[model samples]
Target: MFHMNRIFRHSHLTPYEADYAQWCAEQGALLREGRLSDLDRENLAEEIESLGRSDKREIESRLKVLLVHLLKLQFQAKQVKEGWRSTVVEQRRRIRKLIKESPSLRSYPMQVLAEEYEYARSDAAGETGLPARVFPENCPYDIDDILDLDFYPQAVGSAGGQSDLA
Candidate 1:
């Protein structure tokens, strides 16, 4: 029932829905020219919100990776490898960089720890061929401990509670 000419003629139709590259160029031009009225305000706002969410998701993903490696290091002591330690260190560095860049995200690591820990536990078990029960049901590492570059998890019951690096 819609007519092509009418749809094309409608001022409500924006390049944002038709050609994204063109829309971005047009948006930039609009901003440069101070033509705020011609800008795609709603889509711009949504894009900004999406960016924040993307950073949070990145944090969650990095936390999951870090926790998974830590779990493997802690529970599968016999299988500890340099690669696992490297991954843990790399993920921690990336996570720290993210938090440093966005100070608002400073508390996000702790907030997401428990949920990401559950996922890490499952992943570690699958990767190491160990029972899920081998990992503590709750995360044993505090946020500080996990973030500490020098802090590696010790086997759960080592004398003096020190990490037994295999």
Candidate 2:
């Protein structure tokens, strides 16, 4: 049970927070019966925004997973495992599905690709046991190449990359 004594916060809980199932039923009835004025507009709007945020998070998370494996595939080619390819394929498919669902977010992946690469670089380095410098400072692959299911760099890692770790 939620504590009502917590000060500075709302002393009262709305139907949405206090009893979600009942609130949903009420809202559904309001919508179905064409009772627009009786609907919880504010909560509905917030729920819509929350769904968009959830989709964005899903795409970005999948992109991060793709980046990590792609970095491994590009920087530590000799150490590549079948599991990495499987992960790459899965993440790409999932990311593409999210973008397809929300066309407005089509450019979102490219916009945040570099930022996601930073996380990938760190994770790849740790996973591959190679220094972060072994990978490019910025994302070397573009959105299209990353998304391409057939794309996999044949060339090996950086020159003198000390591949002993891989």
Candidate 3:
């Protein structure tokens, strides 16, 4: 169970004590969603509390601030998740594309390549036209590959072999 009580105070809450509850709630929700904020939580609470009055002017002003902050929190979560997800997804897509493109790797049987890459045979098949169960042990393949030496600068020829080091 939770508790909330209100008592009028002649002296103002110095900002920190004023909006603790709302800030705590917002932060709890954000953390539950696996997000973080760099701003001062105490200050944010104070600002949010200013939005709680019954007067039209006070309510509107505070409501605007609260809405903006809420939107910011939601947007931050979205952007962070999307940014991280896209990075992983794009890297995976790139690796699959490379396996399909590499001449040496292409020489190997689709099953053999799929096992070595740890990708699903089905995914490999989709990318390389091979069967999903062609690899060792007949275990279902997920067709995902981790970044390996082939993606390194030297292996990719970006460093022009050992000559760049010399």
User: Best by lDDT, which number?
Assistant: 1
Candidates 1 and 3: which is better by TM-score? Answer: 1
Q: Whole-model Cα lDDT per candidate?
A: 0.82, 0.78, 0.35
Whichever of 1 and 3 has more lDDT, that candidate is: 1
By TM-score rank, best first, the candidates go 1, 2, 3
Output the better candidate (1/2) by lDDT: 1
The digit string of per-residue lDDT tens for model 3 on 25-137 reads 54454445454443346665665665432232322332233222222222233222334334334544454454465544332334343343343333434543435443333
Local distance difference test, candidate 3: 0.35
The TM-score measured for candidate 3 stands at 0.18
TM-score of every candidate: 0.83, 0.79, 0.18
- Name model 2 segments beyond 4 Å from true: 1-14, 155-166
Write model 1 residue lDDT over 1-166, tens digit each, in one string.
2133222223343467797765666566566657677668999788779888898999999999999988878777777787988898899999999999999999999999999999989998999898999889999999998988888888655666667663
Q: What is the Cα-based TM-score of model 2?
A: 0.79
Clash statistics: count for each candidate: 1, 0, 7
Tell how far residue 155 is off in model 1, in angstroms: 2.6
At residue 153, candidate 1 shows an lDDT of 86
Give candidate 2's total backbone clashes: 0
